[model samples]
Target: MTRRVSAIYFLPLVLAAGFLCFFLDQKINASAAPAGFENIPGRILGSAGEAVGDTLFLKADAYFHGGETFPNRPPETKEELGREGFVEDERENEKTLPAQPAGDWISRVNHEVRRHGHYHLTKDKQKEMLPFFAAAVKLDPRNVPAILTAAFWLDKSFDRSDAAIEILKQGARDNPEAWEIDAALADIYFYRKKDYARGEFHYADALRKAKSGDLTRFRRIDLTYHLAESLNFEGKRALALEAYREAFSLYDVENQTPLKETIRGKIQSLVVGE
Candidate 1:
């Protein structure tokens, strides 16, 4: 069974021009704040020049459309997929995706991943989504799903590990004791940012939280292995061995033979010369 720390939903695409036109119409016509709201700096007061509202709207457009005038995304060729290290796009070819009007928070988020998830598998297209993801998080800071998805894209697609770290840090602050966020941060620090010290800290915290919280046995095993990997990368071979042993101890007896053997190999490798 595949395990996911964060859940993602997918959707199809629609006519870009029509979609944006409808979205902008709805947003502009939506009720504005009481009168003096215009006096507030950076307010979206409909009296827009290059105000924050307009800027953000334009930014959102770029985010959604990737600056393309047409909603034309050419299907990937077999060779292209191979070169990009991707498999086939398995989604149904539908012209119109579900409607996710602005402020329909959950629906909008669903639209985000469904619209952009496949693009995220590639380098250039994935980088194009940075603004969109950031905007989504800014719109809903407590949305852990959006935070995790965005940070994952930033780190993996754009090679912007620092940006990913910042996003995850905000998520950690908002959702304190969320092992998923901390665990994700630990992975990024260790693998992407190459900040092993910070990785160790977050990994340890994830372990403590996971043990005390309602984390699944599978998730606990997964985190333990990750912690061991971090320790190994930091050259703490002895500590890594201990972590691997603990992980092996936690595996389900009926279905963990392969995992146990893998952990055993890792432990033996660590202790070979010591």
Candidate 2:
């Protein structure tokens, strides 16, 4: 069951879904014993919800179910250790949360799946997990969480730049104000397509129009970096440096390796601020 959600761990679409993975596990565990046989159907329903979420967040071009998610252009680095790589200590702390929290049923499931996914994202199981998320997305289209995830992972999985671009564009239109939609679209235009001009315009537009206090609320640090990269590409060094700092600061406190190092390098090398 956990194996199914962990499949697209490499995809970026999952990032916007944020923090849903942990709760999914709790619900499943709580229902395991059951007051009656009624819990059986609930368990299956929960799994199905997760599957739909996965499909929307993961895409084949973004994540391959096979040995390599990115064949020609490997990520070379990962960020935040990912939902799959979050520390056990962090999971323990979350488990400590007194338990009164509330959200839509699907949200909780995604949370639990994110927490439980770490075990499944290992080098040995990545091949199996890769296809899992795509299938999940297929199960649920209204699931913005899965849709964005599929699109982003597809971006990483090889050479589907065009496909990725289309996903973001469509997503942005479907969900105009969502920070995730804006951020995802910005990333595609700048990073994948290498069209800094268009990317900068979009990021700036998002930053400008994104609902007052909401504009500053970043769902993904990667968005900040991509925005900064676009600024740099546009030769706006001062703003670029600022964007770079915002992204680096957003890194998860427990994050190790790839994101930490890669972000630092981008800051020092790309941003002109001394």
Candidate 3:
């Protein structure tokens, strides 16, 4: 009888332990399940956003080029056309061929109804292209090409250097590791804004990042040369000479004769100036 009572006590303890373990396991799984499921929706939305961004970029590119065609040739200068034996009439044809404006279905229908069989010149195509690039960046903030191209047009075509600088600053924040952003910043500061100090700062940073990344030797040489120029413009003759010498060292003496000569000229000029 005593042994039977002991057995009954041990059975209740075993049942309680098993129930506790089951409850803890359910709690653990309940906590983890929500986290896993939450990521699924986020991943889906991110992919959809990237796809929409791509579509907007394509539309913007079509507008920028004024058509949908492979290998869009840039508008030729008069000198280039003359060299190519193109007469004035042929040179006129070198301008962007007019095309229907790219837009949503409703917009396309409206355009067709309002101006059927009539072509309009895309003289303000760059301005019209800005909205799409802006929307693309809103959808996908990581769109580097859209950011860079928009900045280029703003600064070069629109004479909006401040706006371009702002956009590039945002891009640099979003993509800290992108050496191209720093390079663009350097160019704008050096050439457009005439802030040689800021230009030197960015160029040095860009060169460091490029060396750490996969930038080609030729490109690195270009960056170093520009860095030297920025330093020279800032009147830091000693540092400029050192940077120029570094640029010269980057050239392959036998194979890159012209490049070596160019860098050597820069180094010698700086040395003579000092």
Candidate whose lDDT is highest:
3
List candidate 2 segments past 4 Å from native.
1-118, 122-142, 213-229, 235-274
lDDT of 1 by residue, 109-154 (tens): 7666653322213445555666656655554455566778788877
TM-score of 2: 0.41
What C-alpha RMSD separates each model from the true structure?
18.5, 20.1, 12.8
Please report the TM-score between candidate 3 and the true structure: 0.63
Candidate 3: tens digits of C-alpha lDDT, residues 31-145: 5322234244323455587678777887787665444322334344556445433223333244362355576898678656642221222445458888887767656556788
* Cα-based lDDT for every prediction: 0.66, 0.56, 0.72
In model 3, where do residues sit more than 4 Å from their true spots? Answer: 1-47, 67-123, 211-213, 255-262
Question: What are the per-residue Cα lDDT tens digits for candidate 2 across 1-274?
Answer: 3555555665655664554666766666776433234334334565575454543344443332222222222222134345453322232112223222367888678545532222223444334443554444334434556557657656765456676666566556545666666666677777667889888777766665566566443444656677787887888888888888888787767777676677788778864445
Give residue 232's error in model 2 in angstroms: 3.8
Residue 71 displacement (Å), model 3: 9.5
Which stretches in model 1 have alpha-carbon errors above 4 Å?
Answer: 1-123, 211-214, 256-259, 271-274
Scored against the true structure, residue 264 in model 1 reaches a CA lDDT of: 82
**How many pairs of residues collide in each model?**
1, 39, 0
